[model samples]
Target: MKPRALMFTLFGEYIQHYGNEVWIGSLIQMMSHFGISESSIRGAALRMVQQEFFEVRKIGNNSYYSLTPKGKRTMTDGFIRVYSLKNYKWDGYWRILTYSVPEEKRELRNQIRKELSLMGFGLISHGTWASPNPVEQQVMELIRDYHLDPYVILFTSSSIVSHSHEQLIKRGWDFAQIAKEYDRFIDTYQRIYEEFQRRAWNNELSDRECFIERTKLVHEYRSFFFMDPSFPHDLLPDNWSGTKARELFFNVHQLLAVPAIRYFETLFESAPDRELQLNREKAINPFIGMI
Candidate 1:
């Protein structure tokens, strides 16, 4: 889909926050602020309304709109999905990723270091740190989150061996309890992910009304693509490559972002009030260079 269409899906609900009666002129102003065209904004808004995300009222050559209950549910769900994955019960995972340095990319290194720290990673040395949990998804998300070029930096895990009891004590953690909780969380995550996959495989939502429903968070995807033009258009491991792999990869990856977005919806729902506000700002101003 076009960038503006995606943006509309992502932020259509937020328009209500500005005013109950969102006018064409107001939309024009908001779209212009993001380098979007009047036509694109109008089209996206109409699509959102059709999806039952918002109610558009026709008033003398102008249309004013506000979020429907579904829109509100979606926006809130989207927030929960994001924050839950990003911020779980994290305590240093008792593992470190280290790299030997030739001393050239100090600034670059520091940037990576700081970005990871914000994601709940902690530095153990000049070039070593442990993530708080065994969350590869969270680690990979951080790579995108920081907008870092992976080639410039190498990541390898440390081989420090310690008993769970010793490690947990040093980290001031309760290993058994956290491990049990992690197991439960993973099981739920897997089930939810499976459900999302099932829906994706079964649903073809490209009809006009479906388009409106599916495009709710397209704006964030558009922004992400713009931010990282080189993001590989690759598929999951199941779709290994030889010939048409690239095409399948691109299509699946593109479609897959929808569920990830939905997952983020739940994450945000579970976020602390302060963190939820921060995440909302992050969604709005993704271009602010890594926070």
Candidate 2:
């Protein structure tokens, strides 16, 4: 994962609820185990602050970071979706959005389309997008942000009787290819699960190794956020491999926790900031009940 994304996983998965604040020095220490350099972690931290992700403060000789309201909302959304067992219930309703922009505003329209795709909306037809996910507030925000309200229209419908949901999905998304990507993710990470389990039983995985493995665990799992829409259970194909892959992610992540904490503790073994890392480390894993 890139530093920005790794930092997001760190904040959302580890730092958000427990303390909701962290020192830059501690972040650099923790991230370095994942082969990130001091400069890179610090630079990412600065960028996050610049982007309003973190509210920054100085206390004497120390710098501390806390989530801005925007960051909190983003992290909360991530938590509720990424680690939750239940996908948002679809209620058999569809959110449909369409827009018509002048040629002079084609670039703005394209930008909206790109971002909407990333948000898991699928193109249902020319100049139209559809998603089962609730996005009314988000769409309104997007319209306001880009001054596109005059050019856009949106609606919701439950009795989509023109075609079966299956046909719409087939036309709107490449779930088959997405399935292949899920399998690749599983293939890449399954060995870590097996290895960690074997060594965990033997009490052999060192803190440093566990730290690297744990960060990579989330980093790799997070790759799906950009690609998979967490489509509701009703929409998934039969015996989807992604299901097993998601299960494996939680299993390995929990299995590695103790050792990862031990390694994280070492980051501030003698620093005055040891208590800061220790408190967050000792807090219950944010993902505990999420599965």
Candidate 3:
């Protein structure tokens, strides 16, 4: 994992629970298990600060980092999408968004496109995006955030006889490619899950090892947020592997949970921010009890 992405994973999975802040030394120590160097962590932290994802505070000579408000919002959004199963029945309407961002503001246009893509909006045509899911609120938030209300128009409507839902989906996304990626994830992680299950039962896995595996598992599975639109069951193909993959991911993740959290808390307890650690209740892991 890249240092920046790995740092986000750590914060979402562990640090946020403790107080949403961490000493640089503690952050480096946790990242060291992933083979990320201290220099890389520091550089990534600096970039995150510049990008407004993090804010830093100095305690004597030590530097502590915490998520900015934007960072918290990002992590919350990501956590919900990654950890929650999307099983809602889709309304038979499509949300269409069209934008006319000016040439001078091409950067903002690109950012809008990227965010839409991440939210599973597929490009139906130039400057037009559509999704079966109801994302009017998200789009509204985006428009408000970037002040693009003047250039963007959103609509909720059903297709006329000219095009079918399947046709529109085909125009928008490559389900075949998505299925193949799901297959790859299942194949790679199934073996790791099985092996770890055996070792866990035999008491051969260390807490540290469990922590590493769990972090790696979450990091890898989190990629699906960008790739999988997570269409409703009725929209997915009959042979979809995503469901099976999700089941396997949750099983492996649950198996590793206790030891992983144990290892993390050990490091967290030793952090220099003693008052925060002492007063804080046990961190509620969002992964636990999740389907």
Candidate 4:
């Protein structure tokens, strides 16, 4: 898994499975379940602490940890991403029914509409909505939770397509003429992948550094859609295997460290550009001094 995803996974497990409190052994055991080493787990914990997402308590030689409010926020964000990446929650319905309500109720309707839309509802008609998926039980719960009325049943229909415009934008999957942009995205993806792979091998990265790197990649990937917000979600084609993009991302993430390190190596071998030359020397200065 990518570092960012892993961080979210670990954080989510802590918040959901375990109580808020954890210790080094608990942390190690949790990571071991995921096949990560104790040292790496400790590193991740320290990084989280630095980010103010976790608080560490020292009791003699052992340290206990718990999520700070910031940590909870991090977990919340991670949970959303994890859901996006692991879309098993989806029930294949993507259609929606929409209609205008009384002006007084429009605000309530809009709120429900936005929430339902995020869950992938398509608007088929005014005041009528359908989900291309069988609405998850959670959806029904949310409606009840929000205290929506029986008249709102139209919002839960199965006749509308589910891949609504907002879902595509939120998932950063919205694109038009991907064929034309394919080359550009491929190049950027390959370059960044290679750069990150190299960073992995050296094991030189501090846990915080690794986390930041992974976060940046996710942001960059998401930014692709942000650049062209005008693209219609309906026109964007989607592959049904909603799980594939995440699988590919994890594979690419592992492969990225190599290129990252190689790019650094090339920088040192060739005199870099002006700004880069300064940075190269700064990076090497300590090692050179040691020699």
Between which residue pairs do clashes occur in model 2? Answer: none
> Relative to the true structure, how large is the alpha-carbon lDDT of every model?
0.42, 0.74, 0.82, 0.47
Q: How accurate is candidate 1 locally (lDDT)?
A: 0.42
Worst 10 residues of 2 by lDDT: 268-277
Cα lDDT tens digits for candidate 4, 92-202: 334434444567877777766655554445444566544444445545654555566554554333232565545634443324443345445566656666665676666
TM-score of every candidate relative to the true structure: 0.30, 0.80, 0.89, 0.43
Off by over 4 Å in 4: 1-101, 154-189, 216-244, 252-291
Q: TM-score winner among the candidates?
A: 3
Error of 2 at 192 (Å): 2.2
Off by over 4 Å in 1: 1-16, 19-21, 82-86, 89-291
Preferred candidate (lDDT higher): 1 or 2: 2
Backbone collision tally, model 3: 0
* Clashing residue pairs for model 3: none
Estimate, for each residue in 54-101, the C-alpha lDDT of model 3 and write its tens digit: 999887888889998667766766666777765777788889999999
Q: On lDDT, who's better, 2 or 4?
A: 2
Model 2, backbone clash pairs (residues 3+ apart or across chains), number: 0
**How many pairs collide in each candidate, listed in order?**
24, 0, 0, 39
Q: Candidate order by lDDT, highest to lowest?
A: 3, 2, 4, 1
